[model samples]
Target chain A: MQQLDNTFTALSDVTRRAIVARLADGEQSLSKLAEPFEMSQTAVSKHVRVLSDAGLVIVEKRGRIRHCKLDAAPMKEAIDWLKYYEAFWADKFASLTKHLAKD
Target chain B: MQQLDNTFTALSDVTRRAIVARLADGEQSLSKLAEPFEMSQTAVSKHVRVLSDAGLVIVEKRGRIRHCKLDAAPMKEAIDWLKYYEAFWADKFASLTKHLAKD
Candidate 1:
């Protein structure tokens, strides 16, 4: 899907990937997630924005704090695309196995 | 791995993704791979080059023909990286299930 391109592009950035990693562990406030990185909160928010735009991260506001979490559903598309090759390789390997057995 | 970003980046293009999808069916010569698309063989070659650069596709030249194939090895890193979020969601869902059972 076209959206998968956006998803992959969003994840291409190391900072965005790091944000996803942090969110994967648990829901975190923007401030807390921004703490480990040297960048300003605005810069971190931009990374989060990109991830959110790509549907890889979901952000929610609870009272005064906004928390972010990883949404892995779109990630399935990326993995599914990759997994097709897995099946291809498996099929190739099976044929190879059969060929070897014939020898 | 930094290369994982390139792997994802390469697959972001629709033409490249189509090339990968085609390759997944079986190994194909460059000319054969280019047949379905309206683009020239040179354009197809460029897409293949991007895929090769990302290590997602492998090309072998035998005789006068070059065979192209899908390489799923590097894909494992991308999937493995995503599976970490799978664990996260599994953990979250498990806790929710436990809480529901208690109610």
Candidate 2:
């Protein structure tokens, strides 16, 4: 439960989502990850910290560089939770479509 | 982006998620929705408000009662965002499986 809370909270920002999207291709040094964002490295680091804390990202330090990697396990958990309601919503949509067709 | 942020933030709490789960069955009175939780109606109301603000729920007034209905469009939007990474993660898992098989 707490992990879900953390996962959702960590992903609640656009910058963090973009960071996650970038890291999906491959691991990146912290500086490289910060390059596309308009914010300072400090700001990007803060966003990365949230993702790391949620276990959605893995950060490793090699020499002076911090490498960020996408860890999709927590995200899988989040997807699993959402999938529970997938059928529910699908049914709702189906019924709404049927209702609309009649009107 | 803001809607995604709001949806994720709204679902960050267990109570809010539980409320969402309940609403999945059908529309529910705010008081009835608060029944299972140990917290006061006000606390549950705040959670519902967050869900409502995120467009994940629809609250309708019927006389003096507030009926909460799950508006799963926002959740669907969230799932769509998360689905963008589904293939990426699946590839990772496949690689992991292949590596483990080699070991």
Candidate 3:
């Protein structure tokens, strides 16, 4: 549950979500990651750091270059949490429909 | 995307997520919703305000009671976004496995 909080917090920023979206294609450098955004590399790197801290993305140092990759284990946790409620609500609604049908 | 940001941010807090989980069970008032937490009712209301602002939960007023319901439209959007990346990453891994199999 705490893990879900961190995951959701890290993903709260649009730029961070965009970074995750891009990395879903493949890993890339800080510059490449910042290419689509109007922000500086430093700004983007800060976002990546937040993601790294949350365990959403892993950063590797390849010589002097920083590489970012999607580390989706935390995301899987968030998704699992959300899915529980999704199924819960679905079941609730289904039961309601059944009850209505009888009336 | 802003909606996604708000949704994620709202869901980021453990207390708020807990509130959401409770609401998934059924609609309840501000006090009823605050029953399970160690925090004060004011604290819970503040968290619920954030969730209500995010559009993830709907707050209704009847007489003196404030009712909270899970408004899942935004959660659906967030899930849809995550599902896209989930599919993308799955495809990427599948292609990698295929390539490795050829070797």
**Winner by DockQ:** 2
Instruction: List candidate 3 segments past 4 Å from native.
Output: A87-92, A95-103, B88-103
Candidate 3 docking DockQ: 0.43
lDDT of 3 by residue, A3-63 (tens): 7778899989988988998998899998889988998889999999999999778788899
Better of 2 and 3 by lDDT: 2
Instruction: Give per-residue CA lDDT, model 3, range B6-99, as digits (tens).
Output: 9999999988988887776677899999998999999999999999999888999999999998876678788877777665335677646644
Look at candidate 1 and give me any clashing residue pairs. Answer: none
Interface Cα RMSD per model, in Å?
3.6, 4.0, 3.5
Q: Which ranking of candidates, highest DockQ first?
A: 2, 1, 3
What are the RMSD figures for all models against the true structure?
A: 4.8, 4.3, 4.5
Candidate 1 docking DockQ: 0.44
Error of 2 at B32 (Å): 1.2
| DockQ of all candidate complexes | 0.44, 0.46, 0.43
Q: Which candidate number would show the highest TM-score if scored against the true structure?
A: 2
* Candidate 2 Cα deviation (angstroms), residue B44: 1.4
Give lDDT tens digits, candidate 1, residues B1-103: 6798888788778889898877766689999999999989999999999899988889999999999987867777777787776654456676466447433
What C-alpha lDDT, on a 0 to 100 scale, does residue A36 get in candidate 2?
A: 88
Clashing pairs in 2: none
